[model samples]
Target: MKKLISLLLNRLTLVLLLILAQFIVLVWLINFFSNSWQNIQIALMVLSLLMVLYILTRNDNPEFKLAWVIPILAFPIFGGFFYLFFRAQNLNMKTRNHLYNVVKERQYILSQNIDYGLKGNYKKIETFLESDFWPSYKHTNSIFLPSGESKLKVLLEDLKKAEKFIFMEYFIITKSKMWDEILEVLIEKQKQGVEIRIMYDDFGSATKLPLGYYKKLRALGFKVISFNTLKVHLNFAMNYRDHRKIVVIDNKIGYTGGINIGDEYTNSTKTFGHWHDAAIKIEGDAVWTLTILFLENWRFSTKEKISYEDYYLDYKVEKPNGLYVPFGDLPLDKNHMAKDIYLSLISEANESIYISTPYLILDNEMVTALKLAAKSGIDVNIVIPGIPDKKMVYMVSESYVPELLLAGVKVYKYKPGFIHSKIIVVDRKVAMIGTSNLDYRSLYLHFENNIFLYDASSIIDMVDYFIETIADSVLITPQEMKKRNIFYRVIQTILRAFSPLL
Candidate 1:
C-alpha cells in the first residue's frame, strides 16, 4: 500500500496526470464549441493551416515532420492547440545559452593540446573532426573490454589510484551490486580528501532511486546533482536527456561506452537473457578531451563555474602511435554530427562495415545510406539483440530488417541473449564505441559521446570481437522475413510510420 501511494504521489506521475487532465478539458471545450458555433470551426481550420505551413518550412528531419503533420492535419481542431501549448511551455533559452558558452570555452582549452603530425589516412579524419572543434590526440593508450565483467574489474582497480578528483556522469545509476561496490570505494576516497562528484539523469533513474537520493549523497560529503529534475507541470524540455556515460579520474584516465552502473549490464541480474556490453578505457592526453566534456555538462547541471586548468594534468606519458579523437553531440546543435560520422564511415568503407546496436529504428536517410553501401558490394552487416528489453521497440527494429535484406544488406540477431554494444567498424581500419545507439533519440535528440580510433591497436581487437560476436548470431534472409503473417506486417507498418516519435 505504501509503495502504491508513493508511486501515485511521484512528481513525474503527478505531472503526467495534470497534462492528461488538461488535454481532456481541451478536447471537451473544442467539441462543444464546434457543435454549437461555426466561427469556432473556421478559426481552428485557419490555425491548423498556418501550423502546417510552419512545419513545412522548418529545417527538421523528414520523419519527424511527417509524424507531426499527419496528426495535425488529420485532427486539426485539437492538434494545433496542443502543439502550441507544448511548445510554449518549454522555452529553455537560459540553459541553452549557458551550455553554449561552457562548450566554447572548454573547446578552446582543449584545442591547445592537439597533436598536429598525422599519418596516412588519419590526416583526413583529423581534418574532418577539427572542422567541428574536435581535436585528435596521439598520446592515449586504449584498452577494449569485450564484456561488462572485464570492464568492472578494471574500473575498480583504476578508481583506487585517484588522487585529485573523480567526475562521473551517466544516464542511469541504480542501487545494485555494481554501484554498491563502487560507492564503498568513493566513500573511502572521500576520507582521504579526494574530490568526488556525480551527475545522473532524473528520468533514467526514476524508478531505481528514491526522490531525495541526491540529498543523501550530499550528506555523505559527495557533490551530486540530478540532471533536469521532473516537476508537476507541463513541460516538453523533459524530452531532452543526458545519455552520455563518461568517467574521468584525475584528468588522466577516461572511460565511455554502453555499460551503465547496474547489475544488468554485468549479467549479474537477468532482466534479459545473457547481457552483453562493451567499454573503452583510455589513458593519456586524450583523457583531457573527455574531462572537458564532463565539465561542460557539470557546469550546466550544477550552475557552478570550474577552472579548466585546475583539473588539467600537465605531465606526459609514453605517446602511443595512433590517433584518438573523442567528441560529443548536443540535440540543440544544427550539425547532427553523430549521424554524419556514421554516414562517413559507411561511405568510406573499402571492404566491410560492421555495426552492433541494441535498437535499429532508423530514419530514411540512414536506411538509404546502408542500402547504397551494401549494393556497392561492400559487405555491410549489423547485429541486434534476439532477446529484447522493450517489445514495441523490438517490433519496430524487426520491421526494418526485410527492407534491408532486399537491398542486399545482411542482418543478424545474437542467439544467446541481448547485445547492448553500440559499435561501428569500417574496413577494420577505423572504429567507434560509445553510448549513442542507431536510433532517433541517440542520433538526433540526446547528448552523446564517442571515441574514434585511427590506426589504434584496439581496432584489431574490436574487429576480432566483431567476428566472434557474428559467429554466435543468426542470419535473417529475405525469404524468411517474407514468411511473417500479414497481421504482423500491418502492425509493423503502423509502428514504422510513428518511429520518429518513438
Candidate 2:
C-alpha cells in the first residue's frame, strides 16, 4: 500500500494523469458540440474526411501517418479536431522557427568547410553531408569512454579546465549528486569569469527538475535556457524535445552520448542495479562541429545574437589520419536522417553489426533492415537491458526480439542491469555513438546528435567495448524468446502498435 501511494504521488504519474484528464475533457466537448446540432455534426464529419485525405497525401512516414488516420476515421467527431488541436509536428515547426532557421544557416556554413581529403566515396558520409549538411573532418582525435562513471570524471576535469567559455545542453537535469558535482565546477568557473551557457529540455526535465530550475541557475550568473518551456496548452508542440546531450569547452573539447545529468547515469544512487552507458570525448577540428551544434541551439533558445566567428577557434590535432563526422537530426523536417543513417550503416556492414540500446521499438523499415542484414549472412547482434527501468517500454522492446531471433539476429540481455548505452559498431571499420537510440523517439521526434567515425581509432574501442558487454550478457535463442506467456505477449503487441505515438 505504501509502494502504491508512492507511485501515485510520483511527479511523472501526476503529470500523465493531468494530461489524460485534459484529453478526456477535450473529447467530451467535441462530442457534446457535434450531438447538440445537426449542422455541427455535418461540419465535423467533413472536416474528418478532409483530414484523412490530407494525411493520405502527406509525404511523411507511412507508419506515422497510419497511426493518425485510423483514430480520425473511427471517431469522426472528436478525432479530427483532436488531431487538429494536437498535431504536434506542424505545431513544432511553426513554433520553433528561429531554432530551425539557425540550424539550417549554421549547417550551410559548416558544410562548406568540409575537408573530406581522399576519403573516397563512402556514401554514408556523403549522406550526412548532402542531406543533413553536417560536414566531415580529418585531423580529429577521439577517446571512447565506455561507461558513464569514466565520462563523469573526465567531464569534470575538462569543465574545471575551461579557460574561455563552456557550453552544455542536455535532455534531462535533476537535483542529484551528479548535477551538484557539475554545478560546483560551473560555479567555480563562473567566479573565474569564464563564460558558461547551459540548456536543458523543458519537457524532458519537467518531472526530474524542480520548477524554475533555470531561474535558479541564472541567479548564479550563468546563462541558461529551459528549452521549450512547458506551459498549459492543448497543442502537441510539447512532444518535440531537444534530446541532444552536448558539452563544449573552449571549442577544444566536446562530449556527447547517452548519459544525462542525473545520478542514475553514473550509478551513484542506482535506480536499476547498475546504469551502464557510453560517451565520446572528441578533441580537435571535429569539436568545432559540436560547438556549432550547441551554439545554434542556444541562439534559438535565447534569441541572443552571436557573432559566429567569435566562437570559432583553430582547434585541431596536427596531421591526423581518420575521418570524423559530427552530425545532428532535427525532427521538424520530413527527412528522417537518423533512421537513414542507421539503415545505411547496417546495409554497409560486411562482417558484423553490434548494437546496444536501452529501447528497441523499431518501425518497419528498421525491422526489415535488421532482418535482411541477418539473412544476408551479416552477424547482427543486439543487447538490451535485463532489468528494465520502465516495464512497458521494456515489453515493447521485447516484442521485436523473437522475430529477430528467428531471423538469426543474435539477441543479448545485459545481466548486470539496465544498459543505457546507444552504440553501434559496424565491422570494426565504422562506428556511431551518441544520443540516438534504436527507438522511434530518437529517430523521429527528438533532436539528436552523433559522430560518425570512419577508420578512426575510436571504432576499435567501441568494438572492443561491445565485445566486453556481450560477454557479460545472456544470449537468447528462439526457444528462450518463446517462454514469454501468451497474455504478456498480447500486452507487448498492443504497446508496440502505438509505438510511433509513444
Candidate 3:
C-alpha cells in the first residue's frame, strides 16, 4: 500500500495533499470555536482587514502587499491566523524609531573622521550619500577576491592570529574539516581563556549540529547560542533566520560575506559542483561596526546588552592608509542600507558596475536603477551561480535575466561552481562586499552588512579580480536562453511571481 501511494504521488498530488490538509485544519478550527471564540474571531478578522488595507495603502511594493492579502480574501479565518503568526515581518513604529536613532548615532560617529577625498570620476555615489546616508568614515582598505578559495585562506590566517576574543557568527556552520580546523583553533583559544563566542542560526545548523550542541560548546568553555531556535509555534520567525556571516577577532579584525562555514563554501562539495563566494577581511575602525552587530544579536539571544562604551573603543591613529566604513541592515529598518549602498554604486558608475550574487530578485526600484544605469552606457555585468542549490530560486532568478539583457547588461554564469558571493564593484574605484544578497529577503527581511571600501587602490584590485573571474565564466546570450523547456519557463513565471516572499 505504501509503495502504491509513493508510485501515485507526484508534484500535483503533493500540492493537492497540502491543500486538503489546509482545508481540514480550517474546518476543524471553525467547528471548535465557541460563541465567545466566534466573537473574538470576528474582532481579529476586522483588525486584520484594517491592517491589510493600511499596508496596501502605505507600501509601494504591490507584490509584497498582495502576498499578504490573497490568502486573507480567500479564507478570512485561516488566513488571519496565518497572518497573525507572521505579523512580525511588518515593521512597527517602535522598531522604526529604534532604526532612526541607531542610524543617527552611527552616522554621528562615522562622519567625524570619514574622508570623502576618495571620490574620483564617480559622481552618483558621492551625491546620493552626501545627501541621504550622511556618508562618513575616515578610511577603508579593500581586498577584493574574484575567487572564494583565496578569501578562505585569508580568513583562516586571520583566525589563527586571535589573542583576546573571537566572535564568529554565520548563517550556516557545518561540522566539516574547514570548520573543524577553525573550531580547533577556537577551542584552543578558549582553553587559553581567550573568550570564544559563536552564534549560528539553529535552522542553518540544524542538520550540521546535534540538538544539545550548545551545551556541548558550553562544556568546552566556549560561549555558544543558537539564534531563533526552531519551535513549531515560532516557525514564522525561523524563516527570517540570521543570514549574516560575520567574524570579529578582538574587535580589531573582521570578516563578512556570503561565505558560510562549510566545504561547499570552499568549493570542495560535489553537490553544488563549483561554488563562487566573496568575503572581505578588514583591519581597522570598521571592525567595530561588525563587533557591535555581533554583540547586539548576542545580547538579544543571551539577554545581556553590553554597554556601548565598553565595545566602542577609540581607534588610535596609525596612518591615513586604511579607512573602513561598515554598515548593517536589519529586518525592522526601512532604510534598506545594503540596497541603498548598491543602488548608489550602480547609479554613480561611469566605467562599470559588476555584481556577483547567488540570487537576483530585484524589487521595482532596484530594477529601475539597474535599467537606467545600463541605458546610460555604463558597462553593467552580473555573475550568478551556474548550479543553484534551490531549483525554485534559480528559476526565479533566471526569469529576471532577460529583462537585464534587454537593457544591455551582460550576465555570466560561474562555470566551475555555485557563485555564492554578494559583491558589487563600481567604476573600479568603489567596492561593496558583504553578506547581503541581491534579493528581497536580504534587502528587507534578514540582518546583513556591507563593508564600503574608499581606498582607490583596493577598488582597482577588486575590479581586476572580477575581470579575472569573468574569464572563467560562461556568458549567457539571448539566443541560448530561448532554448529552455516550457516546463522550466512555466516554473520561472510562477517562481518570479512569488519571488518577493521567497
- Model 1 lDDT, full chain set: 0.85
Q: Name the TM-score of candidate 1.
A: 0.95
lDDT of 2: 0.84
* lDDT at residue 390 of model 2 (Cα atoms): 87
Q: Write down the worst ten-residue block by lDDT for model 3.
A: 231-240
Q: Which regions of candidate 2 are displaced past 4 Å?
A: 1-39, 90-96, 116-124, 127-131, 318-321
Better of 1 and 2 by lDDT: 1
Predicted structure with the largest lDDT when compared to the true one: 1
The sequence of per-residue lDDT tens digits that candidate 3 reaches over residues 1-502 is 9656543453224434565676687667766776567786787688678767766786546768777787676777546666665654443466456555665655564465445564544445544555434444454344555455777778778777877789989888877878877877778777777888899988778766656678988898988998867643321443457888889887777888778888877766667887777777776666777877787677656666456456565554354344455777777645677888887788778878999888989888888898899999999999998888888888888888888899999999888868888889877767788888888888887777777765546667767768877998999999978999989898888777768778
lDDT of 2 by residue, 1-502 (tens): 9668756765556666877888888668767886577887778889999889988898877877888898899899767876777674544455567767887779777877765453544665565555567777777888899987899999999999999999999999988999999999999999999999999998788778766778899999999998877654566445668999999999999999999999999888879888889999988888988998888888877778887778888876765747778888887776777677788889888999999999999889899999999999999999999899889899999999989988889999999999998988888878888999988778888888988777788888888899999999999878887888999989987787767776
lDDT of each: 0.85, 0.84, 0.73
TM-score of each: 0.95, 0.92, 0.83
**Top model number, TM-score:** 1
Q: Rank the candidate models, highest lDDT first.
A: 1, 2, 3
**Residue clash pairs of candidate 1:** none
Candidate 1 lDDT score at position 80: 71
